[model samples]
Target: MNLKNNIETILGRPLTSDELNNINQFKNQFSIDEDDPLIVVLALVGANKILIEEMPKLLQQKANETIDLHRQTLITQSALIAKDLIHVVASSIDSSKSPIQRATPYLISFFLGGLSLAIALVLVR
Candidate 1:
């Protein structure tokens, strides 16, 4: 996705040769792995004063939103992992195995349950 081309298309006009050259140079200089390329391009354009100064604010908002989404996802995943751990613990405890086998499973499940609790606590924060 070429940023300049997208901008030009949005404006419904072809950019001048100088603008194209600048955009090309900027693209080479600005290297980042971003989900949304428009944000980075907008920041660069803002730096050159070719776009509004509010670009950074938009970028900040997007970053905050992304962070929030990831946080929620992590918490949800933690809960799921905890649920699975509990299930494993329950099944192991219910098994009709020898006393020694049951003892080991109980000990393992106790530690795993503790780990799951830690993950849940961390995700909550």
Candidate 2:
């Protein structure tokens, strides 16, 4: 059919091998074995009409901005869950006694120093 050449001309580019093959495959809307040129042209015309009419609606449906609220809700929920998990993890970590308490003699020395200084100050007063 001259439709192939016409499409190429409208596109201002030569049809590639893959494009030509696809056009041939989809040339017959129902059966590829059918050789009725008029049927093929009519089918192509009908398909083009459908695309022209439905593409905008389909595209808008897919890219609609109305889902922003749902997306924002999901993000807010996930962030809240993450914040809760962080608090739980931090509390659990802080509750555990570490070996550093025994490993570091500085803690005991600092405590004794503070007590001695307090006692000295009280005795002086």
Candidate 3:
């Protein structure tokens, strides 16, 4: 694990000559070995920096994914409800049945549709 290369990849750029000099000076002054625990700390600090830089974008992306999933769910539910309503309407318009009996299916479908809408509104909130 080359720390310099790792940091450069995370940053999407190479360190400047001055930055390299600084790192060399710090390493020499501390007598830090390549396998030192300090290297782990440095890597962690680099990771934290990248996370901070990309936090907002990451959050927005997650939010968008959630919205898209909800939208798809709503669409699927709506389609299913529409199909149910169509079936109800078809079953309700029976010429052979009495008026009251014919109206029963429509009333039930309307009630169910309203209930579905109410549930959907509640879920959306």
Candidate 2 residue-wise lDDT, 74-95, digit = tens: 5555555555544544444432
How many angstroms is residue 57 displaced in model 1 relative to the true structure, after the best TM-score fit? 0.1
Please provide, for model 1 over 1-125, each residue's C-alpha lDDT reduced to its tens digit, 9 standing for 90 to 100: 55665657655667678767766676567653334566456545534554454479989999999988888887778767877776777685746877887787767866787787677668667
TM-score of each: 0.43, 0.31, 0.51
Clash pairs detected, candidate 3: none
Alpha carbon lDDT of each predicted model = 0.67, 0.55, 0.72
Please give the lDDT score at residue 90 for candidate 1.
Answer: 61
Model 1 weakest 10-residue run by lDDT? 43-52
Cα lDDT tens digits, model 3, 25-83, are 66678787777868666755655665686799999999999998997788678758866
Clash pairs, candidate 2, are: none
Query: What are the runs in model 3 whose C-alpha is more than 4 Å off?
Result: 6-37, 97-125
**Candidate with the greatest TM-score versus the true structure:** 3
Q: Choose the strongest candidate by lDDT.
A: 3
Greater-lDDT candidate between 2 and 3: 3
> What is the alpha-carbon lDDT of model 1 when measured against the actual structure?
0.67
